[model samples]
Target: MTAIPPSPATAAPLGDGLRFAFGTLTVLPVRVTRWDRGAARTGMLCAPVAGLVVGLAAAALGTALLLLGTGPLLAAVGSAAVPAALTRGLHLDGLADTADGLGSGKPAADALQIMKRSDIGPFGVVTLLFVLLAQVAVLAQAYDGGWARGALAALVSATAARTALTLASRTGVPAARPEGLGAAVAGTVPVRAALLVLAAVTAAAASAGAAFGTYDLIRYALAVLAAVAAAELLLRHCTRRFGGVTGDVFGALAETAATAALVVLATG
Candidate 1:
């Protein structure tokens, strides 16, 4: 869901930024304290922080389940479910809508219209099924390695997913519509700010994996890059096809980044 906006907007405080990020991005109880462009810019920049929280929660659940002897498969499912639960499955819904829009092969305006619909079609259903399965498979692989490995997978992938949002909102990315979440946050972040955020996230991911082994350290670093690269590819295509970013496009980007990160962690 979008962040709530009130009148008499002012420049967002640090607290307002955090509130906006959590309030819009998750089912967390935090109330959005501001809704100005300043707040949105900060919110998009801090999107990875929201992701980090989600990832930690997801990792905790998976690790706990494993400690309780549920096995990796079930733990993987539980871990995978956490992000969806926390975000009210909005990102997943966005992904489905995006898939429908892309698969329609209609003119840009028509495709955008299709995505605005509430119902899921064949393209959306199939895309969601495969994406979910892929996420589960990779996460299962990670858990099979060890609970810690699985936890890292959840943590890094979710962070990467949110990181994608930061990049997608970087300056110059137009909004596909005149209103909605995309428009509010579109082009809000300067390119330099987005890169700095990416660098910080990649470094943290690599450092986290270092606890395991040298190989894991490098793998985790690559996972972040791969995730962002995949998302960037999709972002370019979406911009070209839809004429700019939409809320659905943002959701699709998150899922794409998360899936890519998981794949890199599992296989490399």
Candidate 2:
């Protein structure tokens, strides 16, 4: 039977859009404001879109701050805070748990069990430090160069990371049962929708950078491409190791990929 599409009326509107977006990107774990079992799958599908919107808003804010004479370091730092606010620190928690889980070196199930715990572990601490250092270094470099380039890097890198979520979703099974948001979202993403998002995001980013300098446009494009490749490899490895994806893995991928992208730009 053809499944009836999940509706916003029955689900959380904001959450539903996120689930739809995530489904497009293939990352899962979309939670509605009020939990609704029926809307679980739909919400998972929407997450990527929400993430994209969130990323754009952050980039815009950071770019605006830079234009207003804020240093890149301050602007980058400020921009980063938006995602934490929008997602209520959900991805940051995911980053920590995924690090702990991966670092545990236990069986996948055991590692996931560790992730479920509320306390942060050694792996989480190290991973967070690493990611933060990478981000700061890259952002600092971009800021030193100019505001437009930094904005392009931020926007393109963010879009690419969100796109990677779809690949992650496709590559793994849900870690939990009762078919949580992740499972429901598996195989539900539309390829065309994802491509369109990618195209639009890339175009906008490239245009912005080009307005500043053609060289910057090319540089950001290369960086963004490298970031996407790195994310694909990381997710592929994670999928193979764990037999599926998790919320933490998704967050980790986004942060890692974006940082790597920035670092690449810095070095080049």
Candidate 3:
């Protein structure tokens, strides 16, 4: 077997980290210069930054649509579509694959194979339908409240989605596969670093809400909490079912967190 390529020894950590995160996580044109664990570690740690970029894009489109006089429903749909487009729909696809795998009633190895197949199964299709509906419906509700609310909902939910990936990458999590994205990044993050990143994300979300009022601030933080909680439960379930986390599982977790965050943001 060929030996693994070394990390770019000369590159700055921040540059490599951003490249890895954007290159792997989005359809954006950033080139990934290194594939070694160093880059993966930083990539996972910097996931929220990439998520922030995606969230900003989503928020921008939604705000623009609203300013253009589109109805809340249309603006919500636009906002919801931005994340999918930016990620090339990979997370949504992962969510569907994971649902099919879990719903298959097969052994871990067998279920992995089912998820690896190109076509979506009944469970996958149904899960996608409901997940997309939840995202759009909640977004529409936020947009109905105001452009700021809609944009904040989009921004917070998107960031919370990737924040789950960072937490999921903490030291104890194992990769379900020997090869693939999951194995490359799983267990690479130190526990303290992951928690710190999560705290920062949650705090920033609350700060954004604080501009509105104390209640909004509390709900924003709670939205992040709800997102993390939902993703953690799913992460544990997927680990048990699949033997550990896969790329599909990561995607599922992101979508799960994002939808949960949106749902909470729509409240009050």
Candidate 4:
């Protein structure tokens, strides 16, 4: 799949970007106003905003469950289900495909071919099992601490996951294929834009942590660092193994970063 250049007309308005972000990332019934490179770039930049909504909804679900006398474990399950259900498990599918591709250890072309298959491989199955379990477990721990802690963790983790997309789309990043989401958004994020988003996310995370306690502030910082590290590792690994970033890689990075953030928050 050879990469193609985006046309000048690909850019759209900010409202269109919001529509594209929600329409693409969630099962919400928002009408997508555009489907060009400009919209895609703006959509990726607004991804974290959508994530904030999803995370809040998820946290609310968990808090409600707890108030209704549900066990922390069950509340955690419900919280985890919110984003998965809302997103139609798109990120999970990406994580599965990426795991299968990387686990196969094949050359770039063959690995990409494997990822494109409809059937999930052994590696994909195992990866999904472990990742889901980890999410549930860590979320349960967070809930055990308190509703506010659990909700904050969910919100921050989701935002951090989306933040990875902006970094992945920054200039100099190549698309793995000529078509699809990766190609549309690749190299669209300027360094300045990426830095600004990163700073904003960090500030949001810090503020959220401050509401909990001093220890929580330290934990949140650690989680943010872990999320960033996970995203960087995924980007590097995908670039080396698949020649560049792909839609699947973006999905995998989001899930990995979210998991890392949650794990750090739950344990630290």
Candidate 5:
């Protein structure tokens, strides 16, 4: 089916935007007063802000563990678990569903249908296994460098991941279906808004690198650029394979971007 434009509405208030973002993106208890198209659009725009909160919390946990002389592996595991727990693993589920759909190599309809099934498939299983493992491994390596470095990486990666949502919602992007998140926010982001988000996230990443002293300016910028590149590629691939973006697609982009950012930081 062809994608439809969102209904006309005024820009969401900052209070409503925060409500929508925190309520939808995390399992945190927040009252969402508005559930309209405007709110959804604002939430997508503000997604990176929510990520900052999650990332900071996760980093704090890992840093605390490290300060207590916990092993890098344990610190890493704790750091990784914070976001997953706070977000109710919503993004991970998206990653799994997207992997399953893409791996099916069937028609778009069939693949989407496969993704909607509650049970995990072989593709989803394998993707989750490796992705989660990679997160732990890379995070552990970062922690080995120092608690501050590990915390900075986690913070930057989380912010970068959520920034992908804004890009995915840019104008001309289509919703895979007529209902749900894809329909609610797809094509809602304007070029100006997307650019602003990109700039903000880039600055945040650079600041993190400078604060940590582990990554030089060039390396940090490259890592952010690489993560953004990966997210864009995923968006294009999903559009081709699924005929448009879905809620799962948003999740997939966020997780993929986060992992890419973290991996780059760890390696650098």
Candidate 6:
């Protein structure tokens, strides 16, 4: 059997984690440099950072549309489309597969096999619609009251997704075959870097909440935390059932967290 190559081992120990994570974002095939030392830095950071950038751009466009007299629905739809365009449907694809996998009622391996199929199933379609509807609902509500909060939510939610990746990588093992992107990132990211991303997201969330008197920062925080915890549990289950988390799981976690955040903030 061919062995999965480990991350690199040449770098200094202190910042190797960040370097490895950042490297994963770049266009380099640095998947397996070393294992014990936890050294490779291939292309993992790209997704979250890209999410943030795309989300921000989408929010701006949404806000601009609102200012130009577009209805809340159109603005919300446009904003949601930003990340979709940026990732070119990567997360959505994952989101769909994850929905199908988790909802299929098949064995874990069978569900995973279904996820690997190119065609989206009935469960996948429903999951995608639910996610999109949830996003649009929150966005429309936020825009009706205030676009600033809505935009900030978009930014922070995207960042939170990246942080979720870190949590998954640190806590869960990879699946049997180390062929996909999850294997490329597992155990390679630094906790500190992940914390930094979380901090940034927190700041963004707080700032957004502050704009509206109703922003119950603590409530939103707790909701996000809960979402993360739930995601971790799901990841752990996947690890036990399938040996590790996948890229689709990561994306599903992000979408779940973001949805939870919105719900909490809305209620708060």
3 versus 6: better lDDT goes to? 3
Q: Estimate each model's TM-score.
A: 0.95, 0.75, 0.95, 0.94, 0.94, 0.78
Residue range 1-268, candidate 1, lDDT tens digits: 4532322223467787888789888999998877667888888889999999999999999999988999999899989999999999999999999999999999999999999999998999999999999999988888998899999999999999999999998888888887788887888777898899999999999999999989988999999999999999999999999999888999999999999999998875
**Where is model 3 more than 4 Å wrong at Cα?**
1-12
**Model 3 agreement with the true structure over 57-89: per-residue lDDT tens digits:** 999999999989998999999999999999999
Candidate 2, residues 1-268: lDDT per residue as tens digits? 1233233223346555555554333334543343442344344434445556766777788788888897888778766666666666666777898788878888877887898799999989888888877776676667667776666556666666665565444412343322344444444444554445556545665566677678767766666666667777766666666666666677777777677667777865
TM-score of 3: 0.95
Kindly report which residue stretches of model 4 are placed more than 4 angstroms away from their true locations once superposed.
1-11
Write model 6 residue lDDT over 27-127, tens digit each, in one string.
Answer: 23334333333443322433355446556787898898888889887888888887676656766888888888877878777978988899999988998
Q: Which window of 10 residues has the lowest lDDT sum in candidate 3?
A: 1-10
* lDDT by residue (tens digit), candidate 4, 1-268: 3344754324467899889889887889999877777887788789889889989999999999988889889899998999889889988999999999999999999999999999999999999999889998999998898888888888888888888888888888887888877887788877688778888888778877988778777788778778978988989999989988888888899899899999898774
Error (Å) of candidate 2 at residue 195 is 5.0
Rank by lDDT, highest first: 3, 1, 4, 5, 6, 2
3 or 5: which has the higher lDDT?
3
Higher-ranked by lDDT: 3 or 4: 3
Better of 2 and 5 by lDDT: 5
Which one wins by TM-score: 4 or 6?
4
Candidates in order have lDDT scores of 0.90, 0.62, 0.91, 0.85, 0.84, 0.63
| Clash pairs (backbone) in predicted model 1 | none
**Per-residue accuracy of model 5 over 1-268 as CA lDDT, tens digit each:** 2334576535698889889889888989998898777787788889889999999999999999999999788989988999899889988999999999999999999999988888878998899889889888988998998897788778877888888888888888887878777887788777688879888788767865776554555567666677778999999999999989888888889889888888887764
Model 6 Cα RMSD, Å?
Answer: 4.6
